[model samples]
Target: MTTADSSVDKGSVSAVVGDKLSGRVALVTGGTRGIGAAICGSLAAQGAAIAAGFSGNVTKAEGFLADFQGRFGTAVTIHQGNVASADDCRRVVAEVIEQHGRLDILVNNAGITIDKTILKLTDDDWHKVLDVNLSGAFFLSQAALAHMVERGSGRIINVSSVIGEMGNIGQANYAASKSGLFGLTKTFAREAAFLLERAGKLSDDSVGITVNTVTPGYTATEMVAAVPEKVLDKITAQIPLRRLGRPEEIARIVHFLAADASSYITGQVWAVNGGMDM
Candidate 1:
């Protein structure tokens, strides 16, 4: 029997706590700060056993773990690895399963953007963005899907950016990677459909999985902190809301997609841009 059909019994304590998630285990990549940390806290609050990841920033990861446990009264382990490495991605999924015994969600939120104009952009700069933003998501999703497929239920949410869809100056590489994530999301949704068929289920019935993408606009994250206040002000002036988005706002949408509420939504990108592109 597949893992889903096997019905491995969980401890009563876990069952009680997991009721909100109800047999769910989630891995949130790049979950140490900003939107990632907010997503981790939001999900953990709803009773999902979280395996949060960080590519660098060991100090941030430790602090996040402490805060998460203190607030939730449950320990959330932090995994450190470069998501750009395929082997490291596999190890991430492996560790999550070894610790939690099942995988139900994967949030591909780890990304980096190197800003350089096309006229001055180096091949290294281009590949670096693609490696972290696109390739990292690709590898992690591939490895995580193995466990999700066996369980016959999963949710994969890829975090993208508005610049990816609307295009931004000095961020060609970053835009390209985020744009690529859309294609990957669509492809994975199809693959998940096939797996659902193997599990004798239809899209509207049974425990098949769904994959989607969430794109956030200029949020008050560290990445945007590098921009000068004048430039940030100019940028905010164009936003209909007259301000940057909050990490918690984006985290709310992610929390929804990770839950059963979004099972019917897949292969689509939802932007939390506060009318910047609308």
Candidate 2:
């Protein structure tokens, strides 16, 4: 798709294009593929240097970087670490800062799910989901905030799900973890505001660091590709649009949040669910 129609631009860069994110740096977790990859591309197209974080799949990560470079004529650093691990989260943030000198945007897009009824869910299953989906975002945000607070500007975009707001069957752990992000978003926004105030930088006219969440409905990602055809059909039927969401569509919303234009938006949840949830 054309850049005007889609979040990503597939054509080669022919002329110098002035971008809103020029000279900025961004880090996107789980960015090797799917929705995360789209976010990386979108941000890069807008002239931000990108650091793509992935937990595993070295081959896929390399391919994504190569494709991104080809599309944008710029290389993206690949950071491989499990965001669920506090140490890894710290290391990831440090590496980004060391490489880019500063981080202007952070997208907490890494996540996983173990779909099972609570009755059938094992202890490992519950803990693993929460650790990755909920705790990971908290850990990474805390690590990134150290620099962001000092700079008095930053953007933190958390990727939540419609399931977080509207519950779904067989997703107790997943739902709870995503739901926790809403609280985290609000709390972080307040804390950032307080920090700005303490620094004597708070103003009624200007915005400090912004924190928000993006809830995506059923999207056509690799994870969802695993769903049985019959189950997928049922999911599509529930959507008023009668179709699944696209990763690029969600990425575009994230791009907007990461831009300077969205400075006035914070502690808000932007839903890109195609009318799946009001």
Candidate 3:
């Protein structure tokens, strides 16, 4: 196990409860900004070494990396690649393992959406969304599982959206991609369970690997910043909380599912939306 030697400075929050994830190595895709950035910060604060993956925006990524290092004194590596490509996914996972020596947490947080009403939606738009959001998660999980299985432990946290559960207008492609994650999570969990059982290690106390999905609802992030004020207002009004979710709030839930305490919570979709779709 990786040792926890970093100290939390005044700028950052304290470790979650018991520093439950201390010493683990985490790979967070799309981690340079917004929700992904928050997830990286939260995990690093809890003493996990972070490998942040970004497809572009080197300036933002550099800033995030510097801030993470300065605030938490955590080890962080920046990887540049498009998650939708299988070869890129494999390379990123390999690089993280090479740098950190092991992979314990894989947060498939990278995603994109191309919104258009079904009649107006082009085939390219549909394929692009599915490629990045659904296929990306699958490819990354496949790459990480090799190392995870070898160690007999790992956490795979896929970021889904509330649209997956409750459909949204102009988001058919996005909805489909996110909905696909639920099935993927359950399928991966069952496969891991079978492997553990075959090894005589399947038990409540020793579930080998945990795979879960975090679905955030109407979060305040760059992904949704382009929505017009009227549209944003409508979305907030529908939410019981009367406000959009902060990225950090979503990150907190992801952090929880990534910790040792969440060992029994595999194959579950933990929604962080504020009563948007209970």
Alpha carbon deviation, residue 149, candidate 2 (Å):
0.5
Angstrom error of the Cα, residue 163, model 1: value is: 0.4
Tens digits of per-residue lDDT, candidate 3, 76-176, equal: 88899988898999999999898788999999999998889999999999999999999999999988977887788899999999999999989999999
Using TM-score, give the best candidate's number: 2
TM-scores of all predicted structures: 0.91, 0.93, 0.93
Runs in model 1 deviating more than 4 A are 1-19, 201-204
**Model 1 lDDT, residue 139, Cα:** 91
Best-to-worst order by lDDT is 2, 3, 1
Output the TM-score of candidate 1. Answer: 0.91
- Candidate 2 clashing pairs, residues 3+ apart or interchain: none
Off by over 4 Å in 2: 1-18, 204-207
lDDT scores of the candidates, listed in order: 0.82, 0.87, 0.86
Q: For candidate 2, lDDT tens digit of each residue in 97-209?
A: 98778999999999999999979999999999999999999999999888898888899999999999998999999999999999999999999888988988777766479
Give the better candidate number (1 or 2) by lDDT. 2
What tens-digit string does per-residue lDDT give for candidate 1 at 178-231? 999999999999998887787666556654688999999999998889899999
Is candidate 1 or 3 superior in lDDT?
3
> Of the candidates numbered 1 and 3, which has the greater TM-score value?
3
Clashes of each: 0, 0, 0
